[model samples]
Target chain A: MERPAYRARVERILEHSADTRSLFLRTVTGRMPFYSPGMFISVKIPLPEELRIRPYTIATSPEDGEPFELIFNLVPNGRGAAWMFERKVGDLLDFTGPFGAFTLERAPDRETVFIAEGTAVAPIRPMLRRALSQPCSHSVHFIYAAAKPERLLYRAEFESLAVTNSRFRFEPLIVQGKELYESLSDEVARRWVHGDGERRRDFFLCGIGSGVLKLRDLLRGAGYERRAIHYERW
Target chain B: MARIRVIYENGSPERTIEFDPAAAPFQHDGQPGSVLDVLLGHGIHLEHACGGNCACTTCHVIVKQGINSLSEATEQEEDMLDRAPGLTPTSRLGCQAVIEDADADIVIVVPRYTINQVSESR
Candidate 1:
């Protein structure tokens, strides 16, 4: 990964929810590397008295170089998210090059399965956008998992994608909130059904800590080899 | 005087150090200034994902012992805690947690998630 030359400048801050906020960082120059839509970037912020780095998925398309967008859900009592919420309209954030390799395949594309929980939807949405724009040869299945309906994001947008392709499948699994650790485990078991795995499909998962773990275990048990699985955990 | 013991993630033995109690309390200001300053002062190499600010949680740590003795978690510290994996009651933003007392002994456990996630992502 080459060093990212152009840093992202905060163009505006939009609060999607009480805790979640989207920081729109517009590229000052057109020279930034063209990022894979589904990839994520590292953010460096200056706290009132300190410096911190956090990673968030690139939510906007690369075509929107007018302003690159990164999305983050504040962990109720998180450090980076909290400090990030304090960002003003004109702060500059340091980011390395687009690092994760979670982009859509360039070859004979097989089925695509995207599993998202909580704020994990941010990264997956970009991939979905890519799939929708160019129309890949293979089918795409987008699964969104959250603790409850109230917590799910981009539902309307993803549902719209389904309209574009009947072959596209969208499964929204709502995990009961609270006792969150156990709820996540149960949610994964429910989403990772037997037939769903081992098929010729590429799986992508994002979400909270436990959700990622549950997804990992489910994939490992469902006959999917580890090498085939590509993922990024925030 | 307050005493503190730091154990690195690399299989190194713990080192004991003392500080003057008259100095400011061990409170992290949620910025890149102090914790990194102190660690760098002690010649300890700590990783800051965003150079010490609250942008990332790469500096996450478990307050295995003496957490109660440290300063309270401010809104900034709590915010950064949100994205960290392996959430626990003992977790604190290492970048935010500071050692005030020169005589206080605290132990912190650095989880594999902090190092692992950043490495894999990069």
Candidate 2:
């Protein structure tokens, strides 16, 4: 069967950070499809010559219902970002999705670590929600890295999650520091290695292709199994 | 016009959709048409999580027949298919499999499962 593209209306828009904005879209018809955390949807943007389709990760979980959330950074000349930014409340947007395999994996027995940068936090945010919704024995750590403090998306949300959820920890790393600054991967590896080695750990990396690939190699070289590391590079 | 046969292994029904390349993105639901667009035009809701960007493998379909008729899978599509469950030699992502041969008919099979989750909680 063909997955149908539905019309969604912009319900609200909010400033996420310095350059990022979050848009809330509500289905005009049927209930929003169930999408795991880390899934994305494609939206059709009408350009001057033709329409363009672009994918954006779903920032809110399916459990949220009705309106879905998407966070995007304003690329100086990105057509999709511009189209999205121009959307007014009540304007209709055609989109299809709740796709992508970047969902949270339950490893109740192993400590889970999530590493994300920039707008990549869109998908990771839902996974954190899923992790905290259930009964979890193993600890879950979220490390968000950005070049500057303002670029760390969802810092406040994660901090609040960390405080409310006993099993979860949130670490926000800014790369602007001088001598005291450590690379994101190095900080994650050090923390992972110092833990009880017997307790297995799973790592989820998201961000730019190069960064995810680099971090995956670093973790793999540090003795984590290939299956133990999952990533989605945008 | 090319004829495409889609078999729903989950037992909803089978369909043979006719498409015209010249009228590319064959209009169905006011969307840029592909095999997925056609199927959805006919009300077949095959799972497509990436919205047909060839990013994820949820829209995987087996080209049982007329595999040669469609455009060859690009490196990106092949790479994404590697992660699809129950992969077959003739696997293709429906979003990327555009019909080009109007003389022949294409047959496709949607697998029993498409979601690549560790486990289904919902």
TM-score for chain B of each model, two decimals: 0.72, 0.84
Query: Judged by lDDT against the true structure, how good is candidate 1?
Result: 0.63
Per-residue lDDT for A1-25 in model 2, tens only? Answer: 3556778889998887756898899
Q: After aligning candidate 2 to the native by TM-score, how far in Å is the CA of A59 from where it should be?
A: 0.9
lDDT of 2 at A172: 87
Instruction: Give lDDT per model, in order.
Output: 0.63, 0.75
Best by DockQ: 2
> Distance (Å) between predicted and true CA of A56, model 2?
1.4
Q: For candidate 1, what is the DockQ-based docking class? A: incorrect
Each candidate: RMSD to true structure?
Answer: 9.4, 6.5
lDDT of 1 by residue, A1-234 (tens): 223445667898877778777888876644556566666676665667655555667887776675777778767667877777878898776765554445553422676677777777777877776666655677777767767686778788777778867878887877664655465456445655543444465677665544565666566567666644555544
Off by over 4 Å in 2: A105-108, A177-182, A193-199, B1-54, B58-85, B89-122
* Chain A TM-scores in order: 0.83, 0.90
- Candidate 1 residue B112 Cα shift, in angstroms, is 23
Candidate 1 local Cα displacement, residue A233, angstroms: 2.6
> For model 1, how big is the CA root-mean-square deviation?
9.4
lDDT of candidate 2 over B2-103, digit per residue (tens)? 777888777877877776755666432222546777776565666655656566877789999998887887654665677788899999888888777766
Model 1 residue runs over 4 Å out of place are A1-5, A105-108, A132-137, A177-193, A196-198, B1-122
